[model samples]
Target: MSTLSHDERASLADALSRVLARQYGFASGRRQNLAIAPEQLPPIWSTLSELGLHAVMVSPDFGGFGGGADEIQLVQRQFGRSLLVAPWFQVAICAHAVARAGSPTQQGALLPPLSDGRAVMVLADRDAVELDAEPKVTQAHDTARGWRLEGRKTAVLHAGLATHYLVPAVTPNGGTGLFVVDSSAVGIGCHLSRLVDGSWSGDLRFESVDAQPLEGLSLQHHGEVYRSTEALAIAGVTADALGACEAALEMTVQHLRTRKQFGQSLGDYQALRHRVAEMYIELEQVKSACDLAAEAVEGVDSVQPTRGTAQALLVMSQSATWILQQAIQLHGGMGMTDEVAVGHCYRRMLVLNARWGDTREALARLRGDGMTKEMPGVAGS
Candidate 1:
């Protein structure tokens, strides 16, 4: 199916804004946190599911809305504005991976529940643990009766809430394989932790945990699956960062117009005005980069667009952090307070900076020759 047109996206964004305003009153100076209590999730889940948002990444045949990177990005931006705490990113990315990699039987079993919002799935990739030197899964194997998983997966988002987890593990033969593990199984326990943005993560322990091998699923050929997952995350989180930056910029602009100093509005001062103008310019740059990244992901075949995608993410991360910091400084001490939405947006930007890959990592990947080898036409010398 074709991607949504600009008009469709704008309509969807408007509808989402109405839903968010009615449900959370987010734009009314209300500070929403990332830590969501169990009781707070069901209603929001119902709303998003009813709106066909949760199924955006799944294919149409699998009972989904049949969306691509652009649609997912639009929903994520709205989610960011609302400060939603659901496992949306996890579920969407994992569902895409499964649809691309899993066997027909596996897809039949997993995609419907995910599309309907009856269950959630998380990616159990431990690459983040290497950064923190935390416990991470080192191996996986197949037993006579079933698959056995032995590894420590750390910083799994929404692990406590998901019914199952899609884990990437190194097999004995040294190939990477995907395994599905039931969260309620014996030997599977979640150690919950708080992320810097106040969101929840978990350290998962599996000692010979029973798992079902993803038969017929392979990462071999094209390597598009992994790249697609990363591209989705970059595009999705960039939308979130855009929302936060826009919110902060709007708040700063409003404050400058009303807050008085020297018998005039703060916005009247040349120096402050210049700073606000700079913030606006930077925000626009980031938004443009986000759009470019989304387009690169949408038109993946001929372009070999990984470099452009990484560059977009790098620019977005840096610009977002800069804008938010300037916004905080402009708002004075109130920006540092928890009562302010700008402070929360700042925290969210920091979190998004580290998700998928940080600026340094994205740059390093872009500079490397590995990604360019396959996309020969676009490869940098």
Candidate 2:
């Protein structure tokens, strides 16, 4: 029996298929890993919004279609297949974090713009210890106007382009909590860099930057909500990896059928055929893991706060790397060159592997629960 209803699956399929149809010029970019700049994402993202693709993570009360296990994993896989350059991946992480932890007022403030794809937010909680979930290194002090934060975050995904940042900090009373800071705050400073996949990340400094407390993010809910956000992030990355693996496999199969070797099509090689079959099996398993993680998040179980996001990511890291490697090796020398989209798929998967959390980091989540869990947004202090 399936956890998702027919309508949920069908709706996502229809929307994503339409998105694939409307998205042209995606494959021909050749050497261009990022097809559009961050600023240029609005028009394309707006089109996705029209298709109701961006509204999947938020509830209908928050100006979204609904939140379930169905759409996000499916859509993210498709995004991976096309090697999408938009900040949709990061944006989805921030959006769902808010959905899980925000107050009604905060949701009212953030979700509509997010659901329609007009706003962007990034989480800035990683500090000296990258995997810590409860941020204690970033200190928040009550100010005359609001709050002032002082700390630094490294490799904040899409920090340069995001208008707002969800920053977790230690309250003066010693409670750990989350706060919302404007990217344009006076004391904030950001030095940006491009990742291998053409997405932007930043090394950020907050020298007493003015911020508003995300008022409703109470202590009782902090750990679970943080774990939930980490799960959503994992789901997005795993979904991407799955999609890229699928594309790489398909691309490899096509290359095998058309390319000639030793007076025979590469597909005629028994060894290579066996490798492809093994890869297909790995891809199906990876896909199943991603789907299950998504379902777990929607189901909201206690023991699995990250909804198996960490487990899914670990599975993806191994499977995606193996599949992409096979794709590259199967394609011969052409795989090493940017002239082929297959190379792009490999690079994108590598980039995803290193970002947020990788296989080792994911394994830490399985090491233990609570503060010991290896998840994004932890304050390993």
Candidate 3:
């Protein structure tokens, strides 16, 4: 259940919508600037901080709202509609992990800066961490001085903008351990690249890099932490993709109503109307799946969160692809151009689908988990 009342949720969503409308529209070069040089977006980030969005998921002990998955869904939905590129994965995943499991010292040092937008911390692991995949390159060694991390993490989300990295490594004991590495540390190397949706990612290399563990967590418990954190991350992006799907459907519908062929608007065509109806059905399913996943993340009372989240992503990946493909097909040749909003929406959805675990892998992960009859969003449920 949501901590905020219905009115408050509406008010928050309206505020976010107004701000993005005023300052963050995808008008030609502005979209290009936001995608290519997000570092130049300090003003927008500052505005979001002042609105207390960064503090939404942070713990109240560190002067935050201590909100749950509902708040994350609300904020991310607005950003997704506008296709705003920010380091939100950092807040949604890394900071949540620290707040949920960090020692008092770690929380005190990290959460305040994060709440005020002074710092951004990203998760550095393999592309498939949602499946509990072991790190292929990074390893951690313990010494009297502390933990030292070696090896590299590739395709790190928002890595170029991060102040720190929450990295998972294979420890000498063969258990997975989480560590915090300062991006400016001496042994670190970062190479940035532009993704298909015009967002930035980094290939990060660490050579004998100094690091700090989230205190009080033994290696035995890190696996649980990793799974929950990654699950929440999936829920976050699913909400974002839901918003994009909504906008894409709306845009395509509008195009169909207006664009005429053979002296008749495209909407007059029976076959095209049928396609729109199918897209709407797919969208409703996506909405259901996304909501179920968010609720699962909030409760986290059982392994349901993991199974439910993977199931939700799979539903979203399949449904959203159909919605966007139909949106593009209905838009005809115009949809293929970057100027069309649906084209951008398609690219963003593609990235979100593949970012964690894609449909095939998520289905495999769900194959053996007994379905919870109570949560219909999960596979086989």
Per-model lDDT: 0.74, 0.72, 0.77
> After superposition, which runs of candidate 1 have C-alpha atoms over 4 Å from their true positions?
1-6, 27-42, 128-137, 219-223, 298-304, 369-381
lDDT of 3 by residue, 131-178 (tens): 454434477899887899888777787887888899877777766677
Among all candidates shown, the one with the greatest TM-score: 3
Q: How many residue pairs clash in each candidate at the backbone level?
A: 0, 7, 0
The local lDDT score (0 to 100) that residue 354 gets in candidate 2 is 66
Encode model 1's per-residue lDDT on 172-265: one tens digit a residue.
Answer: 5545666788888898867887666667678788888988766654533223554566577678888888887887888899989999978999
In order of appearance, the predictions have TM-scores of 0.87, 0.88, 0.90
- True-vs-predicted CA distance for residue 18, candidate 2, Å: 3.9
Ranking by lDDT: 3, 1, 2
Judged by whole-model lDDT over C-alpha atoms, candidate 1 comes out at 0.74
- Candidate 3 Cα misplacement greater than 4 A, ranges: 1-3, 28-42, 127-137, 299-301, 368-381
Error at 206, model 3, angstroms? 1.7
Q: Which run of 10 residues does model 1 get worst, by summed lDDT? A: 372-381
Model 2 Cα displacement at 337 (Å)?
0.9
Enumerate residue pairs that collide in model 3: none
lDDT of 2 by residue, 1-381 (tens): 223467877877776766664663455432233555543453456677877766777777877766545556777888888777667666676777777678889989998888888787878767645454453367788888778988877778777678889876767665556777888889988888778766777878889899876556665456556656666677777788888888889899999999997899989989999999999999988888787677667644366745366677778888888889889999989898866878878888878876666677777766754333222333331
Ten contiguous residues with the weakest lDDT in model 2 = 372-381
Per-residue error (Å), model 3, residue 23: 1.0
Error of 1 at 94 (Å): 1.3
